[model samples]
Target: MTTTAPLPDAAPANWVDRYAPAWSRPWLRLGRFDRPTGIWLLMLPGWQGIALAGAMAGRAPDWKLLVEFFVGAALMRAAGCAYNDIVDRDFDAKVARTAGRPIPAGQIKVWQAWAFVALCCLISLGVLLTMGPLAIGLGAGSLALVAAYPFMKRITWWPQAWLGLTFNWGALLGFAAATGVIEAPALLLYAGGIFWTLGYDTIYAIQDLEDDALAGVKSSARRLGAGAPRAVAMFYAVAVALALAAAWTADLSLFFTPGLALYATLLWLQARRVKIDQPRLALVLFKSNTWAGLILFVGLAAGAGRV
Candidate 1:
C-alpha cells in the first residue's frame, strides 16, 4: 500500500512517496531518501574535492571516481539518517515535523533501524574498499564524526558546525582518492565547504526553531536568533573566500572565478531572503544550495588546467 502521506519536511509529491513500493517507503523515509537535498549536500563536497584535485593536476576528473563517490555518499547519508532517527526517536516524537518519521511514528522498530544503518554502511564500505589506502583511511575516519553528530543538538548550540565537519569529510576523502595524499588545496576546499554547510544548514534549522525551543534542542539557529540572516551572510562570505583561496592554492585556471561568482550570488540570495518567520522560504532556500554546490563543481572542473 502507498504510505499515508509524505513526511512534513519532504518536498511536495516527492518521488520516494509517489514511486517507492509500500514496504520500501518506510525504509526510504527512515534514510531520508524522501529529501534528496541532504544527499546532494553530503555528496557535493566529495565531488568538488575530486574536481579540485583533478584541476590542480591539469587533468580531467576521473569519471569512475565521481561515480564511486556518489554511490558512497548516497549510502552513507542514508545510514547516518537512520542512525540519527534511532537515537532521536523520543525527541523526534516531541517535534511536530519529525514526529512522523518512520522510527518515531512506529513504522520501523529500533533494531530494524539499526539493521538498515548497518546495511547501508556495509555497502558503503564495500565502495570505499575499491579506493586507495589514503582514501580508505579517510573514509573510515569519517565514522567518528557521523557517530557524534546525532547527539550534538543535545549538547551544543552549534550542531550545524559539527555537521559541517561531518558532511564535508568527503572532500578530504575524495582528494585522497584522486592523489593518494592530502594537500593544501583540498584542506582549504574542505574548510570552505564547512562554512558553506554552516550557512545552508543554519537556514535549514529555521524550520525547526519553535519545535526545537520547546524540546530544548540547541542549534546555531536558536543561538543566533535575530542574528541568523547576518550570520549566514558572514558564513557564506567566508565560504566564498576560502573557495577562492583553494583555487589559488591549486593554481587552477582563472576560469574558476566565474563559477565562484555565481556560487557567491546564489548564497547571497539565500542570505538575503531568510527571515525567522518565513519557514517556507527557508526550506526553499535550503534546497537551492544543491544547485549552488553543483554550479561550483562545474566551475571547479571547468577551471582545471594551470594558468
Candidate 2:
C-alpha cells in the first residue's frame, strides 16, 4: 500500500513493509514473507494429509508432524520463491508486478540470492531429516519438480497443473510421516490437492494475465481468458470429488462430511465471484483458500474419533 511497496499482488500494508528492518526487506520480500498466505497454502495440505492419515488410523493428527510440516513449508516455499526469482529474473523485470523484486530491481545480486536459497534449503533439509525414512525420500524426490517449475511457463500453458503437483507433494509426505506407508487414500488426497491448486492458482494467474502476455509467458488464465471462472469452478469440483473419494476410501466417519461441505462451499463462493477483469479480487479469492484448506483439515481430524 505504501509507495515504497509496489508488488501488485502483495497484501495491503503487509508486515514486512510495516515492521521489517530496511536491510532485511529485500530478503524477506524474496521469501514472500510479506504475503504469508502462501506459507499457509503450502503448509495446509500437509496438515490435512496428516489429519486424514490419522483419522483413518483412529488417532488425532500428530501435533509434532503438524509443527514439522509448517516449518518445512515455510522454509521450502521461501527457498522455492527465491529460486524462482533467480530463474525468472529476466521475465520478472518485464512484468509490472514482479519488476520491483529484489533480483530484478538489483537490490540483491544473483549470487546473494542463490546464497539465500542455499541457506533456506539447508534449514528445510534439517526439518525433513526429522521425519521418517519414507518422508525423507519423498522430500528428496520433490526437488526434481521444484527445479523444473520455473521453466514450466515457457513450455506449457497449464503450468498451474505442474504447481499443483509440486505444491501438493506435502500431502504424500505428511501421510507417509504419519503412517510410514503410501496408500490409496493418500494418493487420492494428493490428486485432490492437485485440482485444488489448479483452481486457486488459476485465480492467482489472473493478476498477471496482461503482464504475462506482454512478457510472452503462458498461464491457464490466458488460455481460458474470460472463461477462467467457469474453468476454476470445474477444477474445484474435481478437487471436492477427489476429497470425498479419499475420505470414503479411507473410511473416515460421518463427522467429516460437514467440514468437507464447508470447504466446498468456500470454493464455490470463490468461483462465483472470480472475474478476469478483477485481478485484486482474484488475489483475495486465491488467498482465501488457506482458510478453506484449514476447514477441510479440521473436518478430516474430526473423523478420527468416529471411523
Q: Model-by-model lDDT, in order?
A: 0.93, 0.93
Candidate closest to the true structure, highest TM-score: 1
Model 1 — which ten-residue stretch has the worst lDDT?
Answer: 1-10
Total backbone clashes of model 2? 0
TM-score for each predicted model, relative to the true structure: 0.98, 0.98
Give the Å error, residue 36, model 2: 0.7
Write out the backbone clash pairs for model 2. none
Report the lDDT of model 1 for residue 257. 86
What residue runs in model 2 are displaced by over 4 Å at the alpha carbon?
A: 1-3
- The list of candidate 1 runs beyond 4 A from truth reads none
Candidate 1's residue-wise lDDT over 174-292, tens digit each?
89999999999999999999999999999999999999999999999999999999999999999999999998888889888889999999999999999988998999999999999
Q: What's the residue-level lDDT of 29 in candidate 1?
A: 90
Lowest-scoring 10 consecutive residues by lDDT in candidate 2?
1-10
